[model samples]
Target chain A: MTRDAALLLPSTEPVTLIDPDGHPVPHVGHDLPDPQALVRAYAALISARRFNDQANALVRQGRLAVYPSSHGQEACQIACVQVLDDGDWLFPTYRDSAAIVARGVDPVQALTLLRGDWHSGYDPHATKVAPQATPLATHLLHAVGVAHAARLRGEPTVVMAVCGDGATSEGDFHEALNFAAVFRTPVVFFIQNNEYAISVPLARQTAAPSLAHKGIGYGVPGERVDGNDVAALLKVLGAAVARARAGEGPQLIEAHTYRVQAHTNADDPGRYRSADEVTPWLARDPIMRLETYLRGRGLLDDQDVRGYAEQAEQAAGRMRAGLGEETSADYRDLFTHVYAEPTPQLREQQALVADELSREEER
Target chain B: MSAEKLTMATALNRAMRDAMHADPTVVVFGEDVGPLGGVFRVTDGLTAEFGEQRCFDTPLAESGILGMAIGMAMNGMRPVVEMQFDAFAYPAFEQLVSHAAKMRNRTRGRVEVPLVIRVPYAGGIGGVEHHCDSSEAYYAHTPGLHVIAPSDPADAYGLLRKAIESADPVVFLEPKKLYFSRSEADLTAPVPPIGRAVVRRPGTDATLIAYGPAVPVALEAAEAAAQEGRSLQVVDLRSIVPFDDETVCAAVRSTGRAVVVAEAAGFASVSSEVVARVTERCFHSLHAPIRRVTGFDIPYPPPKLEHVHLPSVDRILDAVDELQWEYA
Candidate 1:
């Protein structure tokens, strides 16, 4: 049996196309995305960042229960989702609201779970995006399953499952990766290593050289990318998607980034981390770097910048307006949708609840 | 339709084959299910009939198997996944409880997980730990999961087909002990409906409600009870989660006495549920308090002590005798 040479000597450096300063950097064998695509990705990143800010504001206003802001990781979320085809599926995690919004899920619907509502707020079938899983790494196996089934049915479909660095420590993560490799499922796993899994940091999660290296053990090729670099993320994730669609099995793309905000509206980052540790990451801000690159390449001017800003503002306003409407959940919804046909016991329980509700109405 | 004698294993295989032949989306998969025809051989000749794409072996991971089945089901494929053994299903409990059970509801009916998780459960063959476990209680406790267990060949074939055809997720528990038990059945006859019970034997003295592995033991007890001049009615509860309480209550009301039997532990089991339901519905029937003939509240013991641990015909008879005692 011939062993992969790269598996024996894995690359330590991440695949990077541009530096933190937005200057072109040399990388082996990877080309930049076309100017139009880069510009579009940049627009998505800005919009996602604005959406994150609005969602945080809504949480403060008591309109939302919580919001896990994907502030610094906008480039990773936007670029990874931008590479998928209309028919392909995207499986995202709780903190992946930016990715969900980037994939055409309405901002209000994407935050519905965090809003403590019944069911996932949007139809996953309509958007080709699975419900944003709050349980870490669980959706990975679902992604692999869908991709494997698609392959079995001779469908030219690939699945992208996005998870956090902390999620890689979950057992489902290992099972998903191993199953994908063994079954040769057409899946691409994108890990945004954003430093913390709530209060826990990456160091506490794994002792491996990197999360990407974990894929090598599962017979999956691993690639690391600058998560803050939109062009690099698009390039690496796009290639991985292409490889999966071509039936080359699965690959793991570890995007190195950091979480810029607290875990959520309820969390206090100051309790665990100091501001000094966060200062250096501010220089590598994804939106600023992308704007710099676009301005330098003459693709963006003052008018274009103002236009993009107006679009972001309008999107945020739409989210605010959507949240402003009052939507009441039906109490009977709890009994329905649990099964195709509710069991006899369920029917009895539903009647009991209905009676109680009626009694309360009379009262 | 001509009648032929077939074992429960062969009946289940035929059920899978028929379902696969009927629907192009029906896929069967699990560890050892494809090539070895499963360790129980219940899936024998399936992979040979259907190609590997339809019937295949999965990696030896229960969570991955079930998770993939859920995905396939959501994507318009009817997937029937097998858990290699009863206790082996524990690894996939998270997937079943969190995703498989909650998907259709979580998606608000935009997608339905038309998946069937077949598990060979309950002990009588004297297997070691982790091999023989009656874990139906766990799945039954979870909402959105339809838990069904069949005893005879006819119900086995019929229930397996209904489960695969159902739009909801079903935990189809096959009694491992009944796998080799043969019965004469017309293969082409109309199968029974899902989530209903059938009367194996009718009488008036007492009612014996049993399912899966315990059904045969209950029938044997009923025959033994007949010799003692006590006519016992045997009710085979086909499904546990959507239990046929109406049939159970009707039998209990007529007989005025009831005994629930199962190989699973008595605590929080299907037996306890039946006893509770009978007591609630048939209180004025006035014979005696319900007695549960079930396995002891302990782990499945070693083979040597399995007979003592499991509810036998004599134990069921003893419970039936207790049903004659007057209660306050």
Candidate 2:
């Protein structure tokens, strides 16, 4: 075994390609993504910011049960989707609504779980994205397994499993990384370190220098990046994805960012944090930072920004219309899909439910 | 039929061998399952026969093994994962309950986790705690999972093969105590599909419903009752979740009395479900209330005191004796 920890350790400082003021920074460790890709990422970030706002509004209107807003972490969400190929899979967490939407899933369908209509709104096989896991860190193992299976089948598929800093504390997280490294599976573990897991802070979550550093013991290389910087995220995550796809092994990436909104609409951030902490992240907003950088480079102009805004509004309008419609769930659906073929007990229960429905209808 | 005296361990090995040979998608992995051939050797020679890709050993993490199995299943491979022992699988309960059991339903049939978790369970192996436990009730209580426990060599081979072929996830409970139990198994015989109870020994006075490790004890009790001039039927329930109520109730209705037996604890157990179902369907034809012969509702005891805790032949006979034979 190679005793060298240099290859496995993350950079001393998180890699950043663009500063908070939107100026390009010199980073010898990593290179920036292409200008076109950065512009596309900027477009996604704008749409995602609007998507988070629209979802939060829907929650208030009682159209959605709850929404975990990825308001400031749009760069990580968009980069997670943009860095992957069509054949690759993405295992997203419950808070990754933005990533799911970025992957081309219908916006309304992406909110189905929040709308309380279904467990998962879209088909996983069709989207190549596993259903957003509510339970923490469990899906990471699934991502590793999918990557391992792809390798076994001689398929060129790299799986990107994304979770929050809070999930890094879970045992499944350790198991997933260890399994991936041991098997040399094509998986890139992306951690959107949004500082807190609900009320818990990063300090309380782990004593490790960084979440990425935890991967060194497992022999999986780690990389830390500025999650708010799209250029940096694209470059770092893209390199990790390419490395994994090239049969180098799994990689762990911890993206340092902040969750500007509460953990969910139900949560009160005031109970744990102050406005002073929230005010700083507002100025460091991912969309504005990327817009500034792209504008300086002349890749994006005023007309282009207006066009992106109109597109975002149209997308949000479509989501509003789709979510406003009534959802009629068939009572019989409860008994279906539990198995390939319903068991005798399920059939009996189905009959009971049908009888109850008929009796209610008669009354 | 070839007269080959086979053990349950060997039968299970042959089942995996056959299934792997038939389907290239089938892969088997678990701790100590590769070159070690597993502690019980149920996976003996699998590695030699199918290479590391098909038959392998995984890290000693139950959740990881099970979670990976679900992923492999989703990606078009049939993973037959082992939990090493019954109690050891507790760590993966979340994976089993949340994902393996709910994936298909959660995805609205868009995805199916066609994986089998083989857990060697029940006491009588003189093993320490965590090595021996009848954990079938935990899996049986979960929906969208087929909980199967075979009592003999033939059933073990057949059920495991059927489990691998199932489109839905299956929790296969292998009784460690009976791993070496020998029988003249006809491997070529077409085994019955899941969700069917077999009348191991048909009788009339009372129905003895048992499964897994409890079957032999119930059968011996039936034999003992025969010497005492009492007819006791033995019913081995192969599958728990998709329970064979038709077969079990039919036997109970014929006997007019039922005695449910299992090595697991009595309260809210598989045996309790059996008693309730039999009582529900055979209530009118019953002469006496159904009785349950099960392990105590306490933590499993040490090996020295396990006999007193586990359901035995005497306990089944006692339950049968308590079935109000006065009416007959």
Candidate 3:
């Protein structure tokens, strides 16, 4: 016979539950969250998912060239972003537009950057975030650099470098963490451990048993969080941010989650994995699991569901309307943006560009 | 004109001292560059005179040093970063390529970074491969940076001073082998414009082109050729980028046959570009194909092989021999 809660086995393992229907049950820790706060997180997740959907549609319609999905990682994004204080810096990877949205960026700005426009999404300082960088693990050092800047300026700021699990395989990642740990720079590295990196599996990525343990090599504390459980993620991120803001150097966090869809709208994962492998995770979906837990505690109902759907739809509609309404960047932007003082060579190059453009106009 | 005899190293130190004295925002820092006075002592007594804040030693990390300099530059400070050796610049490449060269373009001209990278460059020091390598071509190919090398005490003082005062990011390549070589420094007059090349000696037969340490080699070759009654014009292409094609074209048009020389390798070298531009601008005016006397097309050799690898006085004379011979 099983014992009661008081007589249960003592273990350091995280709390888990099983649904009565032979399905894995969800956690109630985040279920007990405040209604307004939960709605903010829910609203952000919905908006991000809607934007991801529309961006793919743009790619298919040929309005945009490529789209990388952030569909199933919405909870990990919103939860981690909730703990950032004002003036906190983020070195975001290419799959981090959801976090960027939560960090106060207008969706059109991301569209412009994705369209290969010369201007970045937003000023790194103005939005407290750098534009999404595509090169794997390179932005990790940039985040450490930002943390060092904060240390020198005596500003109580925490820098978060968010990347995928595949990014840990890069030398720059280890270099950044080692630098942060040795220098005691105020930085937190958040890895959204989404199972695949454009088709490369995490199992093929590392042999350390867990991605979280990789930080130990650099003498930094690390944690593993249930990324689908918004409450667990928020709690872990809040603690990490607090430690960093207190000048305790850095923390490494591995947010374990699964992608309920393909790597992007362009690919079919069926070539790699079966529908059966992903079916179970969809039933325990991040937003769905949170919604069920909230409903279990009487925090959500039909009306709340209706409101979130309406908000997400309207936001998507606004974005769809604003897609091509933004200004188009010119070729002059290429050489103009490179140097404050365009070298004599650049000036000559621009003159050559102008001459060619003028000839094209004549034709 | 007041003249003083100083080695190339002392002249550089004096020029830097004058710059730091003239501008409050000029900052200097790198490895072993403070109390130890740099490996070559080119920055000797700088820390003592300017205080530790302005001239100090940085952490051993190259990326960290450059990353901090970029931050300082963005914050309205003109930082002069010393990349310990020519090859040490590789570690700082990301900061140079991704940030320093692109900050203005990435920001759409809203922000400008006027950072200067001063590197002790090229071979002839009894050092190994990395120390003797010439990386000027790598930076010259980058679109946003201005790369320039000085061939003499006067050009070194003037170009470095101008690079410090310039509003753009400049790669100041200091020829390491010439640092200790004694030179006459004219303390009286201001240095000339950095963007133009000067003709050291006018010749009617062939144009001998070079810059930095190679300029002296070209000069010596011209003097030796003169004893043989071959009038060779030596043109010093001081600034690599924004090359003084006005003077180069004029020289090529007059001399008809041009012999280019560089310490860098012949294949895809800076001199290769020089050959192309001079050939293109003065195509029909050519008395013979543009001949380039340069380092061999291989990884920079050891100190023992350097004499053969680099373009020496004999190599220049050989290139002239290959050019239209006016000896008859």
Candidate 4:
């Protein structure tokens, strides 16, 4: 049966449980999350923000190659990992380092690809996270496939595929959502529309009403939430995940947010837009907004806020020390995993490299 | 043992059926793969036997099909996906190269994409554009992929079975021209190891090397040469990526002359790689400069002109005659 397009459409206005001033905003369908989960999300946001700052410092210190800072989108990042079970999978893009770390991956291991040591520093299977895909929207299809496979095997595993606003312009995005809806795969495509794909604005990226609205065409219901409001994100994402887990098919969630920082340390945002534009987003800072809500409810006191800050500082220090330890790469690593068993040609090439390295040492 | 005469399509169908019976985790899917069977009927009756859960049809999106296959494979399911045609697989090339080929290596062996991408390729049925591209080189050049092509019915069943059981991703290229080619063989025959070349015919003169659709052309050329009192040997290359260097080099060394043939463009192709490798390994034993008979370095022509563009028996013999026969 064909699904009603109107029924699948997102709310014209982005859903908000808490206003930018950190005051609760009651809505018809959504409600505030449990105070415990809100506190956990707050703590993770602090750590994620701290990690982003430290990753920038590492880049300046010559310890890391580069990092795509999720400086302003912490609510969306934490909510993605927080909603999934340990048995579920997370397919993240390179810009999703914040979520990767929030998923309990070691900060240093999570930065492996950005560090230039390997494509992925940590074992993906151990954490049930895919490697941080550098190509835009390419891993979305993989997420759909995993969800479909889980359904086939009678496993109740849900998958979350996270991509940026720019990724919505990619063809794989359409294909992934269409396949997920057709197969009724238990997956959520979480699109963090932070208003830019590098320098291109959301206005130039699409003519659609919203990224979430793009899902309705594929039979996947769409939802939009206030990205700065942690209470709202937790509520919407949690509900979407539950629907998927209950075999209601895939869901698409577009978090309306902003990228306060430049695309990366190398980018100069000053060239693309004026400081006047960032001033508005700073007022709607996800961390500050969430902190105010927690404080107002007495769920988080000054002591708890200070404790989370200290905990984030400790994590940053540990990551800094770990990354500071310089290590040489093993040449054999290049050929070792190209195949489960190295082919003869690869073996011969490995030997050639080894022979050349020894000759250079002799010289 | 009773030998059953089977077409290459039927053999492939049986291989998939047997694989599905043996492993519950193995699945078959692609466009038109279920209910209607594949366009070539390669997956004929699979959905009926295994049910739609095991055998299914996907949307008409090549990248989606391959991308989903990679994900399924990562999750411990051996997925066999079919690209409706050779050219149709181009849209999925990024997924194949970026994810499927590098999934294991990039993840440092933590993930394995055990998938079989079945692409029916090559021109002999006078197929129009997009249907007759011999795209083996694109896959063969990729580091982590295994490129296999079967020349006959037996190898179609045998090699596809091997590809399904493989621990890594395999690009199984089926020669569209040979789909209905008949051969009598035992279905339970133990197949030769992958990446090993098989000597189809023995001779003392120049060796004719080929794979896929070109293999039959080379054999026909060799027979034509034999009638002219020129004993030309024929060697079928079953695998293109982990090239059978030993078997190929040995044949070139014994014959002291060689000719490579393939349906893809000669420049920077699998045929070019074969010539370069044989020349490097058997330079001392060469009685003549190695030659190659390949499709012209242009887009596959219209159905009427394909006969001229594709490597034919005449083209193979011409390449053989150019192997310094006077010096021999």
The residue-by-residue lDDT of candidate 3 on A1-363, one tens digit each, is: 112332222123332332312234455432334556666777777777887888878778766666777778887888778889877877788788778877878877766666666546566657877657776776677677567656766789898889889999976677777777776788889999888887778989998767777777777777777777676677677778988999887888888888777876778898888889887777656777667666776777889888988988897888777775656668877766665545566778899999999999999
Worst 10 residues of 3 chain A by lDDT: A1-10
lDDT of 4: 0.92
Share of real contacts kept by model 4?
0.84
What digit string (tens of lDDT, one per residue) describes model 4 on residues A72-106? 89888999999989899999998899899999999
What DockQ does each candidate score versus the true complex, computed on alpha carbons? Answer: 0.76, 0.90, 0.30, 0.88
Model 2: how far is A287 from its true place, Å? 1.2
Using DockQ as the measure, what is the rank order of every candidate, best first? Answer: 2, 4, 1, 3
Summarize candidate 1's per-residue lDDT along A231-341 as a digit string, tens digits: 999898998899899888899999999998999988989999999988899999988888888899998899988888899999999999999788898766787889887
Q: Model 2, range B110-220, lDDT digits (tens) per residue?
A: 999899999989999888877878888999999989999998999999999999999999999999999999998999998788899899998989989999999999999
- Model 4 bad stretches (over 4 Å): none
Return the top candidate by DockQ.
2
* Candidate 2 residue pairs in clash (backbone atoms < 3 Å): none
Candidate 2's docking class is high
Better of 1 and 4 by TM-score: 4
Which CAPRI tier for candidate 3?
Answer: acceptable
